[model samples]
Target: MKLAIMQPYFFPYIGYFQLIHAVDRFIVYDNIKYTKKGWINRNRMLRDGKDVIFTLPLKAAPDSLDICERSLSADFDRNKLLNQLHGAYRRAPFFSDAFPVLEQAIRFPNDNLFSFVFNSITGICDYLDIKTEFTISSEMAIDHNLKGQAKVLALCEKASADVYVNAIGGIELYPRDAFAARDIELKFVKSKPVEYVQFGAEFVPWLSIADVIMFNSANEIQENMLGEYELV
Candidate 1:
């Protein structure tokens, strides 16, 4: 079986989905230390031909905690933020068809960011009709170390994955010889730019998937155009 592991992100970009789509089982690594400026809580959107970013405010987050254990800000104003998203993309040509779904997704009742993120991802999976099984890396019983390549290899052994798939960002973190020692094939996914016409302007590459979902229906977005990655 194929497997990929990554941190849980809030309404992340297309590269996130591409990684999930390319693997049979995808693991969300919630046990690692959470970085303050990572995609864990924010993503970019388009507004008036410019980029606008939306983020989930956190409350009393510790510098040592991983994203999985981080909490949302107590002062979070869900309705107000929802309105900002609507105001930003409501003018896009396909907004009429896509806003309701995104609005519903952002307004989901849960306050915990992790639960909120997982639900949002599941909702997107439903919208696209993707059937890949999602799992948590912390829940597995792996035998390798949690630092660097040992962590990945350990997770792979726990998942019983023959081919371990990961994002291109790990080009330096992973050791090919280590995976080969474990008899597991390693494949990296290089997600290409997904372009769409927004408001009849010049096409830009790599807008967040949330932006796409805000401008197009799930059915329209479900059509995977550039497709998956192939390693050399």
Candidate 2:
């Protein structure tokens, strides 16, 4: 089966979805170290023609260690953030239909970044009608190496995966000969730009579906997804 592994990200970029569309099973590496400044708890969105970042705040503690094990800040007030998002996207064309879904997801009572991100993943899958099974590496019998080829090979063994597909970003980090030695074929995925009409006369690229949904109808959004990305 085709397997792809990635860290759980909060409303990740389009490349993240491309990986999901390419694989049979997706393994989220939530058991790994938590990155303090990555997309684990934030993502970019378009706001009034400018790029804005939305984040889920985490409470810091003296002993905060693992990213996978870390929880959202205890002081996080869900309703307040929901209000902010609503105000930010209220005028979006698809807001009426998309807001409730996003609001309900953001209201989930969880403290971990993984829980938040996983909820977003499920929401997006539901929105886009994707049906791929997702697994957590920590819950699986995966190997424990975290460096370079060994890490990739270990994850493959854990999933019993024959063909391993990953984001194109890992091309330099992994050596092809190493995966070949272990009888596993490796391939990379790249996301092509999808264009859609927003509120203006011009088409925009790389804006999140949230941006499109707020400014366009679901039918138009679905129609815009006609473009396809590639598995390199």
Candidate 3:
């Protein structure tokens, strides 16, 4: 089986989904330590023809707490986020079709950070018609203490994966020789440049998947998803 693993992210960019779609099984690495200023709880969105940021508030926890152990702040108002998205993308061509999916995802009842983000990720995948099987790292039997490539190899072993696919950014982090020695092929996926009309302005790239869904139909988006990457 082909496998890919990544930290859970809230409304991540299209490349994130491309990585998930490229693999047979995608693992959400929720047992890892939470990092400040990371993409785990925040992502970029397009507003007024420019990039803007949005984030999920989390309850205070030790810096070392695993992502699965963290909780959303009780003070987070789901309606406020929905309002923000509506205000920004209400005029988007496909808002009516896309907003309900975003609403259901953002309003997920679980306050745990990982659970909320995982639901959002899976929710979007469903809308996009991606059927890759998902696994949670915390539920896997592999030793979780191993860092970097060691942990990745262990997880691949546990999954019986002969091919390990990762986002292109991981090229420098994983040694090709090590994976080759284990009879596992390592490959990276680089998303081809994708552009679409957005309010008749110069295209903004790398916005959240929400923006893409708002401006494009499900079929168009799915075609873009399947055609927008090359394995390197």
Candidate 4:
């Protein structure tokens, strides 16, 4: 089996999904420490012809807390967030078809941070017709203290993966020889440049998957998912 693992992200860019789709199993690394500056609770979206950041408010926790232990702030207004997304993309070509998926994900009654983000990832995968199996790191039996490449290797071993795929950014992080010693092939996926019409503006790249969905049909998006990456 081919496997890939990544921290859960809220409506991440297309490259994130490309990694998931490129693998036979995708693992959501939820047991790791939560980073405030990370894309865990926030992501970029296109607004006014430019990229804008949006975030979900979380209840206060120690800096060392795992993502699975974090919770959404009780005062966070989900509807208001949905309204912001609506105002930003309501006029896009496929907004009507995409907004409901966004709404269903954001309104998913769970307040636990990891659960919410996991749901959103799976929800979007379903919309895009991605059928890759998913595994949660916290629920797995691997040693939780392993870090970096060791942790990744453990997960791959646990999943019986002969080929491990990661996003291109991980090229510097994972040593090629280490995976080779273990009889597992390591490869990185780089997304091919993707461009589509954005109403009344020059194309903005690397916005959230939600932005791509708003402007493109499911078939078009799926084609992008299938053809948008090259493994190296």
Candidate 5:
């Protein structure tokens, strides 16, 4: 089986989804440390013909805690976020069909940060018709204490993965020789240029998968956007 692993992200970019779609199984990391200013709870969206960031507010907590250990802020206004999305994409072409998915993800009642983001991811994958199986890293029997490539190798071994794929951003972080030694092939996914109308402006790239959905039909996304990637 081909496997890929990544931290749960809130409405991450298309490349992230491409990585998931490129693999047979995807492992979402809930056991890792929560990142203070990363995509764990935030993502970019296209607003006013420019890129803007929208975030899920989290309660105060130590940065060292795992993502599964964190919780959403008690006072997080789901309506406010929905309103913000509506304000931004209300004019989008496919708003009627796509808005509901975003609403469901934002209004998800779960307080755990990982659950919230995982809901967002799975919801979109369903809409896109991605059939890849999912695994939670913490649920695996591998030693969670290992870090870096050691941890990855352990997870791959546990999954009986024949090949491991990753996002292009990590090309420098993983050394191919090590995987070769383990009889596992390592490859990187790079999204080819995917452009579509956004109010007919010049065009903004990598806003969010949410942005992509707002402007394209499910058929368009599944047939064009999802497969618009190459394994490098």
Candidate 6:
């Protein structure tokens, strides 16, 4: 089986989904520590033809907490977030179709950071018709104490995966020789250039999947963006 694992992220860029599409069992890491600098609770979105970062408000807590342990701030205003998205993409052609999906995801009634993000991701995947199976790392039988590439290898072994797919950026983190020693193939997904009309404005690349969904239909995304990458 092909496998890939990554920390949960908010509606991330198209490359994130490309990683999901490349694997059979995609594991989402929730037992991992929450990093303030990471893209766990934040992602970029298109605003006025420029990329802007939107963050999910998390309650003030020690940075060492696991992602599942983090709580959404009490003051998280779902409407405000929805309004921000609506205002930004109101004029886009696919907004009518995409808004419902985005609204359902944002309005998911969860206060835990990981749960909220997971709901959004799965919902978006359903909308895009990507049927890859998902697994939560915390619930797996593997040793949870392992770190870095060791943790990944443990998960791979536990899942009996013959090939492990990862984002291109992970090439440095996971050496091919290491996986080869274990009789597993390691491949990196390099996303090709993804360009689509953004209401005639200068195209801003790598915005959130929210931006992509707003402008492109599920069919367009599935046909072009879903397979628009190379495994190297």
Best by lDDT: 6
* Backbone atom clashes (below 3 Å) for every candidate: 1, 7, 0, 0, 0, 0
TM-score, each model? Answer: 0.91, 0.88, 0.98, 0.98, 0.98, 0.99
lDDT of 2 by residue, 21-82 (tens): 78889988777777778888877676666677778888774444555667788878889877
TM-score of 3: 0.98
Instruction: Please list all clashing residue pairs in model 1, or write none if there are none.
Output: 34-66
Q: Write the per-residue lDDT of candidate 6 for residues 1-232, one digit (tens) a residue.
A: 9999999899989999999999999999999999987899999888887888888999999988999999999999999999999999999999999999989988898899999999999999999999999999998998899999999999999999999999999988888999999999999999999999998989999989999999898999999899999999
Residue 89 Cα positional deviation in candidate 1, in Å, after optimal superposition: 1.7
Better of 1 and 4 by TM-score: 4
Worst 10 residues of 6 by lDDT: 44-53
| Candidate 2 vs candidate 3, lDDT winner | 3
Off by over 4 Å in 3: none
Q: Which runs in model 6 stand beyond 4 Å of their true positions?
A: none
lDDT of 5 by residue, 50-72 (tens): 89988888999987899999999
lDDT of 1 by residue, 126-168 (tens): 6777788999777888742468678888888888899998889
- Error (Å) of candidate 4 at residue 45 is 1.2
Error of 3 at 132 (Å): 0.3
Alpha carbon lDDT of each predicted model: 0.76, 0.74, 0.93, 0.93, 0.92, 0.94
Worst 10 residues of 2 by lDDT: 218-227
Task: Report the error of model 6 at residue 200, Å.
Answer: 0.3
By how many angstroms RMSD does model 5 differ from the true structure?
A: 0.8
Backbone clashes in candidate 6 total: 0
- Taking all chains together, the TM-score of candidate 4 against the true structure is 0.98
